[model samples]
Target: MKHLSGKLFISITAYCAISFSSQELAAQSDVLDINEIGNVDISTLLEDTKTFNTIGMGIALSIAECHGKDICEPTVDEGEIGQLIETLDQRIEGVVSRQQNSEEELTPIITAYVDTKEKYADYLERLSEISKPEPELPQEEFVEEDLFTDEDALTEDEYSAFDDFEEDLEDDEDLDEFEDEYDLE
Candidate 1:
């Protein structure tokens, strides 16, 4: 009777120990982030999946390392390795679908932006052409008459010299006397 009791005690303790270990391992598994949940755009998610292929490979390699020598070749049906791969594939597919849908939805918006940019460029070109200074009205060719007599052709310095000469002659009485003495009429 004591042996039977001892066996039952051992069984219960083993069960509890197994249950605790499983729970601890489950807790160690990755959980999705809440911030990631809200800010997930399609393109970003697809990019993430594309980058995650490396991680997926790493995980598979780890599984292989752990179960490489296991009995019965460790069929995926009874293992988590194949299931993890399948989950990754499903995640990639979901991301691809979302990316496709987002691209389809944004097509018009992208087109509109490109069209607007082209229009603005054309408008700027036209404005630049319009605002450019035109060839100045053909300048008239200026002609100079005889410099000795033409007042318009005389520079300010030349005019002032001529005025000074005229004043000196007016002040000279000899010129007046000579003119009167030589008069025969």
Candidate 2:
């Protein structure tokens, strides 16, 4: 009967421990600020993750070292823990506020940049229209000036050569007559 009572007590204690641990985990998870952490840059995110991991490991080691000692007592000072949590909350809020301010400050500069870009594009379009080449109309047919007037005379030898060339042309017969005489057809 005593052994059975011991087993029952151990079982109840184990159940209570499990329930308490689960509740603690749930409470810790509720306090996590997803939005505050999400806004952090990649470099800072990595650094913070590394720092937190180191701190968590140190705490875990401290707890392990205190095993079987009075230092491993389950009792916690709620006032001190609450103060630390509040300080951390304030820091997170400050970071979030700073991020919001930076975004607000940049808004006008971004607007001005966009406006300047649009105006530059409009100016370029106007310049292109003004600089465009005009279409060419059909040019007038060129009328060459008379290089030699009637006052210019041909020499006698030049005239005779011209007459001889004309007479030779008139004396030449058609190719059909020449072919008929030769019986080439």
Candidate 3:
């Protein structure tokens, strides 16, 4: 409850500050007091107040963000801002020069890669052409391959051995006798 009341009080205070400032800012948008030498416009005073408020809020947010860490404040000093800007300018120039140098250095390598890629594509195209199935020959032109040629004739001795084996198996009487000896029934 106490914390809630505290937050509510902060909200009210912030609201009042913004509301009162906005009322003071309801004049000519041009805050430059040109041509009038001494007197300043009410809007000019409000704008200056708003600028200070914004800067203060920025500092407050930065401090809050680094609440628990070491080196809580901004690293830059009031005097070092110009030096930091100069250092950044030098670094940007260095980066641009390095990019140009690298492009010059790598040009040949990039050209070689492109040439090799084209050559590889051509090689693959040739492989595809070589791998296509050949067209078949017409049936009239196709000849069956023969297993034997002119020197495969049978010999005279082989024919004589076959005739003798047939003559020896012509005894049906002896064959019937052998059958009768083996029959049990």
Candidate 2 per-residue lDDT over residues 1-185, each given as its tens digit: 99668645644554454355435434543443444543445454334333333322332332333334432322222232343344345434544455576653333323332343343344334333332234466554445367567767688998999999987776665566788899987
Candidate lDDT scores, in order, read 0.42, 0.44, 0.41
lDDT of 3 by residue, 32-135 (tens): 22322123433443344353343333323333333344433331123332332333243334333443755434333333333433433443343333322346
Error of 3 at 108 (Å): 59
Candidate with more favorable, higher lDDT: 1 or 2: 2
Best by lDDT: 2
Of models 1 and 3, which has the larger lDDT? 1
Number of backbone collisions per candidate:
0, 0, 0
In model 3, the worst 10-residue window by lDDT is 29-38
Candidate ranking under lDDT, highest first, comes to: 2, 1, 3
Task: Give the runs in model 3 whose Cα sits over 4 Å from its true position.
Answer: 28-47, 50-185
RMSD of 2: 34.7
Cand. 1 TM to true fold = 0.24
Per-residue lDDT, model 3, residue 56, is 32
RMSD of each: 35.4, 34.7, 33.2
Candidate 1 lDDT score relative to the true structure: 0.42
